[model samples]
Target: MDLNLRHAILSNISDNDQSQLEATIVDAIQSGEEKMLPGLGVLFELIWQQSNEQEKQEMIEALEQGVKSATAGS
Candidate 1:
């Protein structure tokens, strides 16, 4: 997603009553629902915005490792 939309979503997360939204995300993940991934993309975007370059690099490395692990398992 584009940075502007990411910022907008993060702004909404900051400004809105987020408890329900957060619950929904948690529920989706716990249910092992692939549909919830788009919601997770919002989370990833927010994390990206809040992180510095070094932190982002670390996060990406972690994500890459996770992906490799998952793919290997599959």
Candidate 2:
């Protein structure tokens, strides 16, 4: 079994510049489709793996706020 989903996803976007990467992430998230989850998970994994402690905390805070706001608005 040779499944390398993360590598495949990364390789597909390796040549993308910062703006392109941002657009890719934003589009995937904004679409709100279940099929887009794997790519988003890969992106999130990369971000988490590369972030420092403070950055991780900030991300967690932002995620908490987003969840709270989303639920409250519903």
Candidate 3:
């Protein structure tokens, strides 16, 4: 059984307005619930799929720096 979680998530939110999408993302992130992680991952996947090389590089650098900062803090 190949369950398509990302497809389901995207279908669920595809009709949302910009403000709704913003709220969904903000609430999901702020709640820090494990359940929200998959939704966030789907959002990130969509963003990655849409981004060009420069944007992707910037994202990668930010993620690297963020991990470094977090590890340092820990």
Candidate 4:
């Protein structure tokens, strides 16, 4: 992420909201719980805000391909 955008998001969001997001991500990583990955919605929103539709489609396709490979390996 760009420093300018990071600054913008931090400037616009409340400190408590930022803390909650951090905590959620940390909990998800520590617990290995799929449900805790709701923090990824923030990532989706950031992509939506920053990218064009074609870019978003490419991103989604890449993620789908990554999942397929990951599960195949498992």
Candidate 5:
């Protein structure tokens, strides 16, 4: 079977409102299920594509800090 996960994921959330999207993200993260990772990646891709340069830089910094913190705690 040929599956386009990104397209499927995007279609699922395309009509979400702000609160709905926030809840979807929060729920996915809190669930801590590996299967949710791809969906989160797709969401991040959408955000990255739409963000301005400064926003992208901010995201990169935040991600770097998160990675550092995660590794530090381990």
Candidate 6:
């Protein structure tokens, strides 16, 4: 079976409004299901592709901080 997970995930959320997208993301994270990771990755991919260099740099920094915080809390 040839499965395109990215396409499937994107298609599922393609029509989401801003609040719907936020709710979906929040629900996914709060649920902490492994199945949701790929969908989150696709969302991140879209954000990354649309971001400017400065925005990308800021995102990287934010991600680094989040990782550090998560690690420290563990």
Clash count of each predicted structure: 0, 0, 0, 0, 0, 0
- Expressed as tens digits, the lDDT of each residue in 20-58 for candidate 5 is 999999999999998899998988888999999999999
**What is the lDDT, from 0 to 100, of the residue 52 in candidate 2?**
100
Score every model by TM-score: 0.62, 0.83, 0.87, 0.45, 0.91, 0.90
Q: Which residue pairs in candidate 5 have backbone atoms (N, alpha carbon, C) closer than 3 angstroms, thus clashing? A: none
Candidate 3 per-residue lDDT over residues 1-74, each given as its tens digit: 12598778989999999999999999998999999999998888888999999999999999999999989957
Over 4 Å off, model 3: none
Ranking by lDDT: 5, 6, 3, 2, 1, 4
Evaluate candidate 6 by giving its C-alpha RMSD to the native, one decimal: 2.2
Worst 10 residues of 3 by lDDT: 1-10
In terms of lDDT, model 4 sits at 0.67
Error of 3 at 13 (Å): 0.4
Global CA lDDT computed for model 5: 0.91
Q: Which residue pairs in candidate 4 have backbone atoms (N, alpha carbon, C) closer than 3 angstroms, thus clashing?
A: none
Any runs in candidate 1 off by more than 4 Å, and if so which?
1-26
RMSD of 2: 2.4
| Cα RMSD, each candidate | 4.0, 2.4, 1.9, 8.9, 2.2, 2.2
List the lowest-lDDT window of 10 residues for candidate 5: 1-10
User: Where in model 4 is the C-alpha error above 4 Å?
Assistant: 1-36
Better of 4 and 5 by TM-score: 5
lDDT measured at residue 66 in model 5 versus the true structure, 0 to 100: 93
Ranking by TM-score: 5, 6, 3, 2, 1, 4
lDDT of 1 by residue, 1-74 (tens): 66786676667567555786777667778999886676679987667999999999999999999899989957
Q: Considering every candidate listed, which one attains the maximal lDDT?
A: 5
Instruction: Give the per-residue Cα lDDT of candidate 6 at 30.
Output: 100
Residue-level error in angstroms, candidate 6, position 13: 0.8
Predictions in order: lDDT: 0.77, 0.89, 0.90, 0.67, 0.91, 0.91
